[model samples]
Target: MRKTAPKKRRWSSGGLAAKQFSAKMANNEKCETKPEQSEKNEVLEELNSQKRKFDKIAEKLQSIEETVSKIAKLNDDEEKSMMKFKEQIESLEKSNLLNDRSNEKLVTRKSFVVKYVFENLEKYKFDISKEEEHFSMNWHMEMQKNNGYLGIYLFAEPIPPFNDDWSIEAKLEFKMIGKNNSSVIKTGEGIFEGLDGNGFDDFLKWEEMREDYLIDNKLTVEVNVEILKRTGFGKNNIREFDESQKEVSDVILVVQDTKFYVQKMYLALQSSYFKALFFGKFNESEKSEIELKDIEADDFQNFLELIHGESSVDDDTVTGILNLADMYDSPTAIRRCEEFLLKKSKKSTVQKLQLALRCNLEHLKNKCLSKITTISDIKSIMAANLPEMDLSTSQALLQKSLGFWDE
Candidate 1:
């Protein structure tokens, strides 16, 4: 059963007021005033009833306002939740794309190998390998012999221009070779960023390795690192150059053992190098495969994609693509790179000037040199790693510096 509030006695006050009024009239002998007093009491009771109704209406208005405010707050919370969900989805997509697969469009699958040689294993306490340059970064190894266990550590000595907030994922294989053609191989993977490194302290038992794997008091271990991913140095590839489109591809150009499959006439029309090799008297014209030397496969891929009307050049890859484009005499590729550098690139003025001078990009060269109005600007451009600037460019900068001092 439902329970409700007790009822209020509203009629007692009006009855008491009427009795008091009648007593005052009887004592004053004003029987004729009784009618007027009754009318006045009626009006007072009506006003009290109207006041109660007003109080009830005010309470309802307050409740309605509270309800509206709560609804508005709920709407805001739902919008915030939706925005957070969208951000999480985007972040997950980026992680999924880069985690498992190494992108071919912006890569060199094979990094260099360095061998660490140990001699007289029982005599030396600790040894290290000479640092070698791979992927434009230094790498070496450190070995420690402790308590009948050998600790092996491979490190990527982070170098300049990549020292800040940079990271690389590499698949590593370390092999310990024996004199009798037997080997103990250890394979691992690591992500090198900042001060964090990876290694195995108890890599092998020293006694057994020295007894079985020693070669006349010497041991040779090979370390191979293949970089799978890199970040914070601008390695994004906007276009794909996969050769799986085999039905349209005619030949594969191999660079440093990396293959790029493409059509002959498409490249031949864009570059004289391909034209002469594919259609001219060269032996490569008749062959289905060719080798390009002293070039990065990633750069070549971006260069080919750019010539085919793909936007693939950026600050990190513009230099390499220009190097190949200038070598192969691809006019369209050169123009596109020059245009990007002049208008869109965020490279420093000094760096852009050097690239302009080296590639003989006349339009870019003039624009960069013209931007150099002060002596300090000229000094900065000169101090950078600049190739031999042509005579005309040198004269222009010299004249600009002298003119600035005079002004």
Candidate 2:
């Protein structure tokens, strides 16, 4: 067996070369596999990013749709409300109860009340021409509740050297009417007095004029009135009537200067009594010896010329005379007022200033048809115009026209 050991065989050149080629191929496969794995991981990350972006876009679209729906609903509601308001306005128009002419209606009401009161005064024979009247009334039911009630007020323009003390008197009587109509009530009275100048400063004067009556279960009523004239420094003198004879009732008025004996009578109306019967104007017939200061002779003569004027005089001429009198503080202003009262119409009511400022014959003629109620009103109006007439004295007159400190 020791002799049989074979000699070691050497490798072939081709076989070794083949073995090296196989090793190079295996390394190339490993490198290609690693690059493919890296590319797959990058593709997966890109897909996830695209999916997240799509989800955000979808959420935004859903929010926009909801907002659009809410906006459409709000628009519909507004349109409905507007239609309802329009319909209501049309209904009001058809009814004619709600008015478009509210200011006109208010003016009508004021004018009507004034006319009513004026007529009532005429029935009372209060000599609207000689005596002054003042009043205030409620504009509404609510005003009546809060401010009491409506009343007609009467007053006199105090004679110069005016004093506050004045007399006021009132009386009342009533009678029941026919059958079951006893529920209706009427009243009558005989004397009334105006407050003195001081009444302007105090409202209690109004309370003194008011009166109330109580009846026992009477339904319908009527009344008769008799007012006698009497005068005192602070109170009125009332007369007692003989219950049997209605005609003989009378009273005497004693003023500081003279005495007035009057026979009083009354007339009946729907809701009130008229205050006038017949009165005779008389001056001191007998007792003339007492020497009291007489009204100045010039004043007395001028007063006569004013109320009873010559008819042929021109209106502008009178206006000029009055304006000059006002400037110099003459009594002629009172005369002009008397003339204006005699020749007044609706058109001339607001022309006091116009005529005074332009003192032309044409302007004065035009003013002939104005409503001039009182001398004081005209004088006040003319005085108000003085500043506007002369530019040189305008500033001074303007200060005066603002009215006195007392006003």
Candidate 3:
């Protein structure tokens, strides 16, 4: 009875309460762990999103860098292409200039012909002796083109007897007559003295004469005879003095604040520039004094001295004198200056070469070139004072250098 009673009461209150408490504690622990896991998952998702955004930005930056690199390469290519095009254009222009120069040289090798004749043999004859004791004759001269040569032939009638000890002298003048007698194209004087009874005959190459001297295929010839007179102390003999006084200077040349008393005739005879300024149709012909600008007084004085044949040339003054001679168109002074420069060219090679190029002195230029023996000498000359040279002179020097290399 006692054992049965204990089993029936096996479910006590205290044991039941403990079992409920344990179950409740297990449920609360599960709820707390669920919230913590949810929160951790949300944080992981946010981190993944940020990583994707960073990857996308990196990809865009790489694309932009590639585009910039390609653009820079294209710009470089364009610059190279433009440089090549410009070089090609310069080459084409140089080729065109060479072609033009070649065309000009072909046109300068042309020739022309001219001729003339004279008549009336007796109209130009004169007696050589007062008593007419010496033999004399009348002659006619003719000028004509024969086989591309100018032929000057003299014709005479009743040929004079030839004498071994005596010779008949005749003076002949040839003139190129212009249209309407405007001006004499040119005049040539010749003297003929020989014992040969046959008249004198002369020939000249047509190409050798000046082109301006030939006028409308015609020329004129005049003949005169030299008279012989006895020379002794006699009543008929008289002493004569020149009695020709120099005319007063009519023009004054003021150069660099210095005044120069210049004769119009003297200047006109020495320089065509002065002749035109003083005697031509210009207004300066009426002026008594001309003020020259940009001319040095000392240089002008040296020029005057050269013209008057009262000075000697030196290295220091030769270049200045040559420049003045060229400016004034004084051929005599030019010739004199060129002669002096040519003699000094051996010692002053570079100086004379530069001067020759500046003054257009062909013979002096040739002499200067002859003095240079090697390419080193040429290079030295070109390097020295190159900036002081003019454009034409520089071009001439380049051409000369090229010629030397070609040789």
Best by TM-score: 1
Q: Which pairs, if any, clash in model 3? A: none
lDDT winner between 1 and 3, please give it: 1
- Residue 135 displacement in candidate 3 (angstroms): 65
Tens digits of per-residue lDDT for model 3 on 31-136?
A: 2222333422433333344445556767998999998687567677786986788899977755453233334312211111112233321232111111111112
lDDT of 2 by residue, 288-335 (tens): 222212222222222223323423123323442343333223333434
Error of 2 at 281 (Å): 22
Query: lDDT scores for all predictions?
Result: 0.63, 0.28, 0.46
- Lowest lDDT 10-residue stretch of candidate 3: 18-27
- Give candidate 2 regions above 4 Å deviation: 1-162, 168-187, 190-337, 340-407
- lDDT string, candidate 1, 1-407, tens digits: 00111113411111111000010000112223223334224333333444465567679989999986875676777868867887999777544432222231222244546676677455665666767555555676656664667666665655445537887877766677664456666666667665444455556688867876676677777776777766554345565556775678998889757677788999989987677677866566688888876556667878877998988887756877887777777899989999999999877676677677767788888888878766667655554424445556655665665576467
**After superposition, candidate 3 runs with Cα above 4 Å error:** 1-247, 344-347, 385-407
lDDT of 2: 0.28
Where model 1 places Cα greater than 4 Å from the true spot, the runs are 1-239
